[model samples]
Target: MSERVMPGHTDGLITLGAADALWVDLTTDSAVPTASGAFTSSPAQARMGYVLLGGHAVATVRAGDGRWSVSEGEVRRAAAALNAVGMDRQDLVRIGPFRGAPRQECDEEAPLRWRRRITGELGGPERAARREVGRPYHLAGIDWRQILVEQTRDGTHRTWWLPRAVVRLLDAAEHAETQARDAGDRQTTNPEGPTATPRPYNKELEGQLYSVLSRKPGTSRRVAGWACAVCRGAPATVLDHCHEHGYVRAPLCQSCNTLERPDHLYSNDIRVANRYTRLFHTDTDDWLRHWHRCPGCRARTTLPLPHLAAWTAHIACRSLRPTHRAPRGRKPCGVLRVSWTGSQNAPRSGLLTVAVDCCPSGEHRVLAQVPYREAAERFRIWLAETAPALAAAAGPDPLDGLPAQSRPVIADTSGEGLALF
Candidate 1:
């Protein structure tokens, strides 16, 4: 067979076959290094060094650091050796220089072993390895093999291969630094961010919520049957319970449930709360108890008195700072925007301005511009009954014509004073 020169071929180097790529170490000082003492062209004469076998070429020298990219077929053979011992090719990334006892099969006291080294401009692994100095950590894509000893006719001699070798891979330390920088950027941009991610609807957790609510005193099932306590439009799929106090609050739709999360309702911004609690018509005490962060005591419980009067009494605090200032930025997908348009101190002074922006055409419509408390309640009723989407969700208002005794056993007409949202 005639030999054809491969692209990017080096001068004075022979193109070795794929079968010889694994055994032959490509690292050498001479123009051509052989494994054996014989100068005749043979596979066994090739020098030993770290090899990167999985590339398309039969053998390609990357650098003078004794590294070679060998053929794919040879790489699989090396990978099979690792697989035979319950090791994976990916494991090479994490296992930094196999420090454990050498394979019992090998006769030599110290045989050529795999080692990990840093290469390229991927940053230093020194600092990343500091915390785990004694332990093994992951590097990106490289593995190395130290010098091999052979008993030759002349004498026992060590190959030109270095003991502690190098390769290139994704540095774990740099990855961590990148994550920290991203977190910092998020904090700087949105100071009022959520502390935790909202959990997805869980059926098992929902059953637990129902079990707990059944034992609780004031959780009446007749309040709003089958409809979400928040947005009466969607079906009540999530059973919302206060994670801190371990008390059941109300049944909420998946969308509305996320709004009631501590992370979403973190601030004292009433407008934000109002938008979330727009259609909430349940035991107001439960809502207040779950999320009312007292301005005076800085406590998040509705203790001493768990009613509307208690919330009004605990509104003012010496250390309280105004949270209703114009937001630094607007959310990308806010469906509802609420703002107080008049004096906030006076009882009936401000107009609870509410705008709906969740339209398909992106049209922002002012749904309500009414006074606080009583007017807000009326607006909620009007929206639920008249809006095409909400009217279907509200489902004819269960209390339309039921007998006074049968309709909603609990008389909760405290929707006005319960504007604590």
Candidate 2:
């Protein structure tokens, strides 16, 4: 067999025939150098013949002749060897002569292995064609071998048929890209003054604004006004740097700004309370509670309070509570008396009462007259079971609605009120 060496960063594409089958000698130090060609070539005549002798890289071989095919197992082995050599699956781009042959067992196992090796490397796999042929050494000197391979990157222009309106929108996006580039260039160059610092642009703010507009909620002027409100200033002159960095001072109202004080927002006590409440509501709370410590004050006094009336109402509606009407005949079967005691100094003051009667001879009967507190405990148990189901039925859980990383944590503790609770 004759051998040749072509050296460069550019891809080497060699065409081989039956008699011109390339014998790849990878044992040499310079055969497949770390910086040079890290690939191999062989002919797929009557049998697929390509040996990965020795190299710290992957080898891709395609059949030149249409007589032989490459099996998926071969591709998988090649990929595995490459991976062992510290090369990622993505490093092996393509392998194949990809000529023509009769249809046979495509041996999809290889491609699947390739997928497993390179799962999530890209979004997913693309569609491609395959062929099969005969060879001398098919798995130990057989007559035929199955060859399966796909193109790494084809320069095929994929034309997307779009509606005229969509085409117009795409044209608008192209124009926007051009305008953005021009704006960026302008921002970089201080052409007007000699020593003036170029104003830094906020890409995040621009993106956020773009997101709002893409919804097409209202007119540009109205949207601009809302953006200004968010910025807490004239939208045109508002330097967006602070807003982009999550500085709450930008778009909030004065009241909200005051409410979101440094002491209040980042307080360890508040963070711990919030986290405790969140944990109390989630199924993962059991696991998270062990590791859940306030990063702010490093305190562990946080507790979940039933402050949300709406949630309480939801719990009450789902519980087996009695109706408003009293029973007709007085029967000493069982009585469920519920009463609410209000604190005198509480913001909201009210007394609530509920009574349930049990039927003596009927299938349904009350067990005992339990305290409202006990009933509340029972409600909590029911919530622990049914809240998730109710959340599922209502749509997504509120906790799930939070961004993956924005689950909240105290970043610092430098205040007097840094207690966890």
Candidate 3:
């Protein structure tokens, strides 16, 4: 693998230190951004530090002489940066509300409030490279949580650690969320809030998009006549945005933007759009014609969600009659593991996770979750069509694994499925 590149900040440009720097907003075209600051110490680091440290950010740190003399401007920028990450002013910066210090928010915290959670210096000369013992790649995907950076550039070379209180709060939050989930079900109660607040739109992002469009002559006006920004084939028209956040996501064609829209809409995450498009195309007849073989059993299968349901149901119904040997003796084979890049399942939308593993050992890796309703449809359809065949030789189904169950039977319809009796 190639070594990672660290970027620096150019004048008048706002640097985004997150891994998905491309998704970062630009105030204007003149605010030219560089990748240098993304690696080394910069304002973005402190902002990330403040958040990761659980909102305890002080403007200044103690000097060698033991005098706390950090600038007010630096502190204000730190507060602004913290607020930018989906926090409201009320959640962070406080004014004239404390009993002790006049500037409670700044003075309440101990010295060097912003602390680094991820290990190792970001990057630098051979000395810094040696510190990286498999460093967690600075950016934490679409979670929007940035890595905290410590400004140790000063000759002192001091190291900072998270205060005990902050660690407890983060641990508690995680534990509560975990207990609430039951086999893919969402948390019954949210620690975040009764109803989560909507995030503000990013002007820097808007300007960045305008810059990309304005690069070529009349591209803005020409987009309506061209293909979608995502699939890049269908004619484009509508502007995709989060109905909740009221922010523009992208300029997509009708199909790309319409999956689970309005009610199931996700924020403007780059990965989600890509995943949605992949699953969307897979459901089409064209994609099905090109089949993939499963790695576990080496069986060429159709789209998993439906194909799995179909094959399983056929085996189930065939065993209901008799003469068909029990399949429990055979090994329970054929497993598919699916990792989704995005979803309407809010909390997990941006994070890459294992959505489902079909069959047994989790072998076939798919990129999207199979909708529950669609899977059920395949089972019902297969059982209906194969009812009459259960007695016809009782030939073994290549996919059967589990033994049969006796249940209400559908009338045998192998001939035409038209008997109303």
Off by over 4 Å in 1: 1-238, 241-256, 259-268, 271-370, 373-421
Q: Give the lDDT of residue 219 in candidate 3.
A: 52
lDDT per residue for candidate 3 within 1-421, as digits (tens), equals 2222134422112222332232222211211111222222222233212211112222123345543232333223322433343322111111111123222121212222121222213223542574455333222111112312133326654332222222222322222222222113221112221111112222222312232444667554344434444444344444443222222344544334433221111221111222222333444322222112111111212223222322322232223212213465543222222222332223233222222224332434333433434433443454335333322212233334312321211332422111110
Q: Model 2, range 281-383, lDDT digits (tens) per residue?
A: 5533321222121111012111112211212322342254333334785323333322334421231442323333353443233223333344445444544
Q: List the residue pairs that clash in candidate 1.
A: 25-47, 25-48, 34-45, 35-45, 35-46, 36-45, 140-169, 140-170, 141-169
Worst 10 residues of 3 by lDDT: 89-98
Can you give the TM-score per candidate against the true fold?
A: 0.21, 0.15, 0.19
* Evaluation by TM-score, superior candidate among 1 and 3: 1
Instruction: Please give the RMSD of candidate 1 to the true structure.
Output: 24.5
Deviating ranges (above 4 Å) for candidate 2: 1-309, 318-340, 343-372, 387-421
Candidate 3: give the clashing pairs: 7-35, 7-36, 7-37, 8-35, 8-36, 8-37, 25-204, 25-205, 26-204, 49-148
The per-prediction tally of clashing pairs is: 9, 12, 10
* Two-way lDDT contest, 1 vs 3, winner: 1
Cα RMSD (angstroms) for every candidate in the order listed: 24.5, 23.9, 24.2
Cα lDDT of model 2 overall? 0.25
Model 3 clash count equals: 10
Quality of model 1 by C-alpha lDDT: 0.30
lDDT of 1 by residue, 262-342 (tens): 111111222233322332344333343233222111121122111222122122110221122237753333344444443
